[model samples]
Target: MSGGTWIAVDGGQSTTRARASWTTEDAAVAGFIQTTDGFAAVAANVSAALAAVPDAPGTIDRLVVGHTGLPIDHASRDRLARMLLADHPVREVVLAPDEVTAHAGALGGPGVVSAVGTGCVTLAVDAEGRGHRIDGWGFLFGDAGSAFSIGRAALEAALRSDDGRNPPSSLVAAVHEVFGGSPRDATWALYQMTDRIDRVARFAPRVIEEAEHDAAAAAIVRHAAEELAHACATAAEALPGIDRVAVTGRLIAPGSRLEREFIDALAARAAHLLTVPSAGSPLDGAARIAADGPSIYRPLVEILTRPESSAA
Candidate 1:
């Protein structure tokens, strides 16, 4: 194996994590750091991660960063690459969308990956290496079947129940228990919270819990499962020769009712297809891409790997 230091970073909107490994002909050492997200925040975390190792900035060979809000355009990606090169002494760097790394970690090869967390997005890669992305339009217009969606639905149901527009539901009681107020008061408070999306998403587990026995909650869960399954199936259909779909993110935790329903719904739509479980975390995928030289992120990798003079 080649002897050098490699760094992998996963930068989400909530938190950022970086792993650094120094490998030589015989011995190797690894370190990890956690910090905030964003270009500057991730760079700072990367520096802190490398601080424990000797000759960090100068001796680093490769760095791969999968960030949540990275730009999709080539010019924008190149701009970010230049910024990273200027900030660090690493020989090469690769920047990719966090979803790409999530798909890589979940599928590791050609297939479809549906990530349902605070938000939802589905990606499919064809046999010929073409990619299709679906339903990542953010929380306002899209992100169907996400925790935020489920939570929002629950809140709506609770409000309807409180106002006597909908039949009384266990969700009303559940919402009152958590938020300690009437549905109207809870709704107003949700609007007042700074991180309303995340705060509202915090109620998703409760929705899931109530779904076990509450008809209204069960309806929300079923609807969520249907929406998520539809996204996965839609993406899969666009990618010819793909028979496997992998699911990632907190919303699809194994053995949960949500997962069971989602898989069943998806299986019904796509015959003879497999729902593969995620084999590794996104950080593992980032490391794999860094070690493998390049794949989907070849453009960014090439731009960063080129000599400074050539780049100029």
Candidate 2:
């Protein structure tokens, strides 16, 4: 049996994934934990996930962690390292921002990865190991073209239209259609029932669909697409050695105009375009990282290109 195992912990804003793989097998073990409160809660989740794993820490040769909102300072790194070390007695550990792992998961080797969810951001890593980032400003100030941004705009329009402050919007109709008869019910579901920004963001697509029939919603999606494209193109231009760009988001639905535009921008900067329809979960990506060691690029490529399982 191989003496070493590779592990990857990927923490997102809403959840965390932990993966472990033995070097000898193509298979990997993985688990997920949702983040209910915030970073501290996520940290506890990670601790519990690690504890539930069968593998002992000393057997783990290397550990790689990617967490959201980890301050890139010495104290922050030290604290996280301490947390991981508390449970896993690995010889080496590599910690990176969750965005970096998202880039790693999406682009695999070296390229730009634009993650558009509740927020928008682009990160590029050239073959030379250089990195560039753009447009990760918080929701109020920036995050243009993000789901939340689009949803917020659409919601404002819907409310305005309902009160006759603006023209009647199909957006209002779409929202009404999506959430049963009452706009109040939908609003409560979004604001009161869930703290999930991404869930709230889902309503943006309805706005996009309505845009074909409603000018206000259309303008919102168009502006969002434009900004998102700009972010992708900017990152690609700043980084060399990037021939592939991976775009991930609920907004970039297949066959949708948003996907077309995002692809066009990436294609403008890179030679190959791979839209992520089957890229494995971050947990699987993490397993590949754990089993492969230093050659993260090749292992990641294999994981991403591999056919996805049909059964859940």
Candidate 3:
């Protein structure tokens, strides 16, 4: 391997982690860094993430980052590469949508990886490794069954109860406890903040916690499950004959309420499908790509080197 130092990052909406591996003629060293989350397209967030890495190996010989909010197109991905290259000392950079890495990490071959965390993104790769993305559209437009969607829905339910437009919900108390006394005021304040989506998404677990006794919360979780299942079905269809799905992210973690809901929903919609555990986390996928994984993934990422050279 042609390596001085190789760094791989998995940047998500909730967390950012970096791993640096350095090798010399006879010595090797490695270290790790973890930081708060950042939007994938924003340079400042990416820079902050990279800066947190401790090793200074002169220049990072190779860097691969799988991040949220990155567009799939070559121009947009390369644009992000350029921005990161300008800030960090690196010989080559590869940028891709976090789902790409999630898919690679979860299932190295032909299958679908439905990543449901603070955000939701699903990717299906055919036998040839051609990938089709489904429902990673962020909070504003899509991200159907994401934590943001569930939290936002629960907030709306709480607001409805507060407004006397709906029946009393225990979620109203949750709102009061989590967002101060007034639901409307706290929600308005959250909207004013830049991290509104993250703030809203943080409420998902509360809603899930109340699903056992709160009718409104149960309804919200049910709908969220339906949406998540739909995305999984779509991804599975894209994979041709794939009958099982691997999932990543915190939302559908093992033994969680949302995980149970998502599994039931998927069973209802696609009875033939099976829910499979992910082989590895997104970070594992990022490292594989950084090390040049199977050819199927090569076309899905944008790689930028020194000078004007860009590779597909």
Candidate 4:
């Protein structure tokens, strides 16, 4: 079993977070750098992220990561593990798709987890260890009830009002307040930004805030929340008898509008499914997987150790 110094990497599209247990203490770093470039770039990005973390131990017992864009095939996974093993003073490396880690972090058992942040994904696992994923198709294809979708809808509503194609909305004024231009100019500014998704997603809170008193914003938020619930339900449907559901990220925080609406919608659609609070972040899940996770997650997470270390 792995013990002592451990490093957990949460490699995401928008930011990378690395947490490590030091020889004498614990240290963590949240470096706001995009880390997921694909299998070819994962090792370097993971290395860069690990370097950003402060106060690392000279040697590490295990490196656990829930990385975006990690290949699912066994050969690619082994190659990635080898690359990581070569770069760090680690005895073992556990690599998995970020979704698996998120699921483990949230429920840690048979349940459905819907993660709604800049992007969104719903994953479900049953008692038999069968898993199915829903949404997470990225902004262009789907990501149905994600922050990007809500923000884009808010901006579109503002532009629609400007063009008189739809009823006037307070979001038009909000567009000017945020982008300091007409609705059309706001659209142009967004299109010109180097990080369009982050820029757009930043505006989601404004939309959610206005949802309290604005019809247009409320409509968009309600639709997105309902869609999020639907996505979670769809994922849960594949899990057979599992009825537990959990949500993670800023959108689902306690009393947020999105969280409230999502819970209401979920109750309406799947009354038997219970929503539970997440145990921790994906980084925590990586640590759990590294230490050899519960039997339910064994089929989903792979813990790879050096032959010599395992033989010991």
Q: Pick the candidate with the highest TM-score.
A: 4
Residues 9-42, candidate 1, lDDT per residue (tens digit)? Answer: 7665334556666533211222212224434544
lDDT of 4 by residue, 145-207 (tens): 888899999999999988999898999998889878988998998798767787788788889
Alpha-carbon RMSD to native, per candidate: 5.3, 8.0, 5.4, 2.9
Cα lDDT of model 2 by residue, 1-312, tens digit: 123666677665444556666433222222222334434454565665555556653445666766554544666566666556555556556666555666766655677677776667777777755777878675668888888788888877888888889988887777777666455567767776545465556677777777676888877877787787677667877866555566665567667766765666555544454445525434454554555543534322212111123111
Which sections of candidate 4 miss by over 4 Å?
23-37, 292-295, 309-312
Pitting candidate 1 against candidate 2, the one with the higher TM-score is 1
Worst 10 residues of 1 by lDDT: 25-34
Candidate models: Cα lDDT each:
0.73, 0.62, 0.77, 0.79
Q: How far is candidate 4 from the true structure (C-alpha RMSD, Å)?
A: 2.9
Ten contiguous residues minimizing lDDT sum, candidate 3 = 24-33
Order the candidate numbers by lDDT, best to worst: 4, 3, 1, 2
Clashes in candidate 1: how many?
0
Q: What is candidate 1's local distance difference test score? A: 0.73
- Model 3: per-residue lDDT, tens digit, 200-266? 8888989999998999999998888888888889888876778768888767778877788888999
Q: Model 4, residue 293: displacement in angstroms?
A: 3.8
* Alpha-carbon TM-score of each model against the true structure: 0.82, 0.73, 0.87, 0.89
